[model samples]
Target: MSASKIAIGCMHLLAKLPLPLLRGLGKVVGRVLFVVAGQRRRIALRNFELCFPDVPEVQRKAWAKESFEVFCQTFLDRSWLWFGSEELVRSRVKLVGATHELKGDTPTIVFAPHFYSMDAGGLALPLNTEREFTSIFATNPDPDLDRWFMNGRQRFGNVKMLNRADGVKPIIQCLRKGGLLYLLPDMDYGKNDSVFVPFFAVQDTATIPSLSRFARLGKAKVVALYNRMTPEGYVAELTPAWENFPTDDHVADTARMNRELQAAIMTMVPQYYWVHKRFKTRPDGEPSLYSGK
Candidate 1:
């Protein structure tokens, strides 16, 4: 069998085990990864140092290591999320607030940050409600893996997946038709339609201004959503929709999105995706943060 097939087989096997067992195994695997993945560990440590400079180095290192373990748990949990029984999945997830109120005529923007269990939040909303869903997914380079991942995401309901390369027409149309747009806008995607914004006191972070546009085009309400793991299972929490969003200025709205994202990330410190180079793309003539120069 091919390597990818073998990996898929292992994921299926992991899916068969209980969540607690998977989490335990994930911790051991995560420790090994933290040691072996030198670059990722460095990047994660650096992110912590940049974001929380007030904290001591020892605490930052501890948070980085714990973040690795939580990330691995989420990675291992995806197989079960994809292939496990819906009843089983439903039993494992708890909706903390009114996430099922998709009855309104206005389109909704579900703003999800990069928490470890963010996928759970994505799955929870669609599974619990009958709202037609739409989301933008980054395509994987490997064809087989890409197909598998897409299938997993769309398994629950009528979810329209847009390729990242595809422009905004389809998404805008979907929103105009009162579809829920599940957006994860925390990552740095270079400087195409993005503007430099402040994230966790880091200046010049590239952030997408699409949220403001979508809210305006669709007349949507922006709802903050996040999922975090607890001893019982996962909690998909939703805040009350924002009142005065998508004002005349797109830049201010983009900054507001980042500020809300920062607050959400604070609720689950270690579960955030710190391995990403959030500060890699510096402005004008600034130096690279992760180049280790």
Candidate 2:
């Protein structure tokens, strides 16, 4: 069997294990990764340093280590979330706060950031409501892994997974028809069609302005869904739709989005996806953040 198939089979077997035991194993694996995954460890540390410069290095390192643990636990959680019994999933993943916003859609866009428990948050929507849901994702290179992700995400309610290459017309159509759009536009997706905005301490962070653009085009109200992983399972909290969003200026709207995201990330610093190169694409003539090692 191919490596991906073997991995999938192992995860399928893992689904039968109790949540506590599976999480314990994930903790062990995360510690090992912290010791051996030098490049990723450095990246996480660098991101912490850039974002939380005022904070002491020792404390920042602690958060980075805990981030690894959370990341691993959330990754292993997919086994049960995707393949386990519905009774188990429904019991664990809790949806809280402003859930009424999801009712009657009225063209809503869910601003889901790259929290460790994001997949859990993704499941929260379809599992709860019967509304038509749509999300855009980049196709994974490995076909087996790609299939795994697509199947896991679409396993719930009426969900349509659109490739990033697929243009915005269909997305807008769904939104206008009172469908939910789960958007994760926080990462650094290169300089193309992105604007330099203030993200925490970083002044010229390369952030895609899609959140603002989509809200404008689709005429949708933006709601933020922040997910956190607890001992029992995950909590997907949906904030009420933002008022006066997507104003005349798209750039200003994007900046406001970052500000809101920053506030949410502060509540659970270690749970955020810090390993990504958030400051990768710099303005004209700026040095690379992760140049050496």
Candidate 3:
């Protein structure tokens, strides 16, 4: 068997384990990775340093360690989240808060950040409501891995996964048809087609202005879904739709998006995706934040 298939089979077997045991395994694995995964550990630390400079070093380190633990725990959670029974998944992942925002076909966009429990949040929507859902994904290099991800994510409800290269026409169409667009536009995708905006303490962070663009193109109301991981499972909370989003100025709209994201990130500091080199793309004549780590 191919390595990816074997790995997937192992995960399926892992699905048979109890949640507590699976979480324990994740904690152990996370601890080991924190010690051995030098590059990733450094990236997480650097991100924390940049985002939480005012916080004490010891506290930041503690949060960093816990972030790693939560990351692993969420990764392992995919085993049950994907292959486990629907009853199990329903019992575990709870969809709450402003859920009425998801009701009716008003063309909605879910501003889902890169929290560790994002996949759980994605599943929560389809599990709770019968609305057609769409989300963009960059295809994995490994075909088997890509297939695994596609199948796992589409396991419940009617979900259409769009390739990032597929452009915005279909995304807008889906939104106009009242389908939910789960967007994670908070990451630094690169300077191309990105606007420099304030993110936390960083002044000129590269952020995709797609949220505002899509909202305007699709005439969609933007709602923020912040997912949190708990011992029981995950809670996907939906905020009320923004009142005056997607103004004429895309840059201003994008900046407001970051400010809202910063507020959400503060609620669960360790649960956010900290290992990514968020400040990798710098403005002209600026040195890389992740250099010489």
Clashes of each: 0, 0, 0
| TM-score for each predicted model, relative to the true structure | 0.97, 0.99, 0.98
Whole-model lDDT for model 1 versus the true structure?
Answer: 0.85
lDDT of each: 0.85, 0.94, 0.94
Q: Write the per-residue lDDT of candidate 2 for residues 1-293, one digit (tens) a residue.
A: 89999999999999999999999999999899999999999999999988889999999999999999999999999999999988899999999999999998599999999999999999999999999999999999999999999999999999999888988888999999999999999999999999999999999999999999999999999999999999999999999999999898889999999999999999999999998988999998999988874
**Could you give candidate 1's per-residue lDDT for residues 8-124 as a string of tens digits?**
778888889988899999898899999999999999999998899899999999999999999898888888888898998889977777654566657899888888898888788
lDDT of 2: 0.94
RMSD of 2: 0.8
lDDT of 3 by residue, 62-136 (tens): 999999999999999999999999999999999999999988989999999999999999899999889999999
| Candidate 3: regions farther than 4 A off | none
In candidate 1, list every pair of residues with a backbone clash: none
